[model samples]
Target: MFAYYLNKTLMHIFYKNAALTDYLKSINIQQTSIGFVPTMGALHQGHLSLMERSMLENEITVVSIFVNPTQFNNLEDLAKYPRTLDEDVKKIESLNPKIIIFAPNVEDIYDGKPSSESFDFDGLENQMEGKFRPGHFNGVGTVVQRLFEIVKPTNAYFGEKDFQQLQIIKKMVAKKNMGINVIGCQIFREPNKLAMSSRNELMSPNEKQEASLIYETLLNAKEKFETNSAHAVTDYVQKTFKKNTDFKLEYFQIADEVTLLPCLRKNKNKKYRAFIAVFINKIRLIDTISLN
Candidate 1:
């Protein structure tokens, strides 16, 4: 009973928009570092981890849950993405956060003028998941820039599961002289090693069970990379993926964690990351693992 009451009280504390901005200004934020975690609604433990980290490390934290339609390359997928703001609000309020939760509707956020600023690179946004879903990264850049403008956080947290997205955002930040510190958090996975994602909510009971294959394949690739040569690792990954005829493989590549450029050989000199994307009945699922 007491817990329920506390939850309600905390929920009421979250101020929206101008009120939130006023509250932040009312408080002297000088030297009180701000941390931001931007996401589309459908809060899960993965998102909570980012929030918890931000709380631990910063004096103030803001979490934005705007399901930016522009980021969705597919209109159907955008329409289908889940929204549980009431539950999500309850979830974040429990943290007693000095956090501003931004939950804006589509029209409220964008003017429908297809963001004029689009990002381009030689290979960063052209391969792997980018190759599979064209123009997806443009949507990412657009919404991220919007969030940066709204929150103006001192540091932002991003998960490594979206390795390419993370890299692209960092590049965008640097290219534009945004000056905001972007921290890439290690991907949070389940006990079975499946990377946590909002889309996981879309999985059926049977699909969830079979979905473990994505993580298993990544784990297999990691093992092969450590002991076997690059050629052997590539061959094993291809063959293992072929066994899972039920799923359509997107792209699986090992790349540097920092630069995100493809890594061919296993070496201790630098950290490596393994990225994978697959489709289970047209629902795209992505996961990553550590190679080093």
Candidate 2:
């Protein structure tokens, strides 16, 4: 019961915007360094890795667990996106009881209007995941910028699992001159090498196990990329998926990391990474690997 009472009394969670602001005022955070980690809240080991780093690096860590509605392109997706607040809180508290959680409702975040705000993330708004999802980054920019405005964190954390999204957030911070350091943490994966994602919760045990092929394929493609043409590497990946027959391959491209454009040939001086999106039934999974 000491632990229970400790959690009940010491846990710092804010569900309302005004309450959080008032609490921040009381604490006078001008001197404290805050690290922010935002998530849609299907707490996995992957999410914890980011939180763990934040807890170690800063005086205060704010982990926001809201499923931003604007980022989803479909109502079906928005409705189905996992929200595991109670479990998420448990996982976070396991690391450190003092960590702050900003888990606001739509009204708390957007004043109940629930519309997206747009930002220019250079040409990054037009590439890779942007080409497929359409306005997904605008919605991402909208919510992240609003969170930055609200939390005023000195530094923020993101995982490299969503590599394109990572690039976009960096661009948004630069364009706005937000002065906050956005740290991109390494991708966390399962024992099978599948990148951990909230969507993995939607898959069955067999499907989740089978999804490991996606990363394995990317690894093979990376090896092939050393001697093969970029076109040849993608074609090899395309055919590999065709052999599987269960996974619906969306798009696979090897691109320059900074420009976010497909690299037809190696420049030798520049770095590149392979990005892929695949579907296991209705669930979509994305992963990236450094090719160079």
Candidate 3:
């Protein structure tokens, strides 16, 4: 039997809109404070950490494991993206929180057409992940907006690993005047300091070891930020990764945390962070670190 948890007790699974709505209705969802954590399946320690935090703070926690195809800029990525629904459910069941797993199919959520709604994130979507992946944030904004409407959670949790996406979602909430609280969780990492990511599943043992260099480089850049200009530090990171053959450095920038615009020089009044995206063994890996 497939066992899940609700209210610190065991329960069965709920899928699609009708079943989920009926289940929530039976539980009087209106009176409960819901915490939502949306994922694209391929659950890992990082995902579990988000759920753990949600359970600690809210009466009911909901996690969605839909691999939203709209968010992928590349067709191959969407196709190759890991889908471990069975394993993911087992992980969620282990949490034993009053959690709802909204594992909806594309047609059910999208109504046969993915949202083409464009959002103006005040240029936040124009850099980094934006600059590289065209139409990615619009897809993100659309799906997240729909999810918010459907789940209507009091507070939603997101990891800071996708620092840019976290910021964009927050901006979308504000701009849309959505009353939901968006919580930014810490970036979970591996023992070697490589940030935990679903994409890490695609890496071979050697690629995984070499991927640690991404975090190591970020740490080096962090130290450089202490005594160097923003441009100099960025240049240093670029050159260092250029020397390594294991990964292709896509783009690295030291930018204002709020605006996400590349900083020409560090400013005392603003918080700066180093954002990086690298292609290791053809898998795109991203990581960020605070410069201030």
RMSD of each: 3.5, 2.3, 2.3
In the range 1-292, model 2's lDDT, one tens digit per residue, is 1122245656888887777777766775567888899999998998888888998898888888899998899788889899888888788888788778888988878888888887777787787788888889989999999899888888899999898899999988988999999999999998889999999999999999999999999999999999998999999999999899789999999999998889987899999999999998999999999999
Candidate ranking under TM-score, highest first, comes to 2, 3, 1
lDDT of 1 by residue, 1-292 (tens): 0122333363323324555566556763578788899988698887888898998888888888888776677899988899898788778876654466776656545754655357875467876767777788888888899778767788999887887888889888988899999888878876666778888889886787788888888788888787777667767777877888878877777877776777776668988887878888877899878888
Q: Taking the tens digit of each residue's C-alpha lDDT, what string does model 3 give over 261-289?
A: 98986779999999999998689999999
Once fitted onto the true fold, the runs of candidate 1 whose alpha carbons sit more than 4 angstroms away are 1-7, 10-19, 112-116, 121-123, 264-270
User: lDDT: which candidate is best?
Assistant: 2
Highest TM-score among the candidates is held by which one?
Answer: 2
Model 2 gets an lDDT of 0.88
Which has the better lDDT: candidate 2, or candidate 3? 2
The stretch of ten residues in a row with the least summed lDDT in candidate 3 is: 1-10
Candidate 1 residue-pair clash tally:
0
Worst 10 residues of 1 by lDDT: 1-10
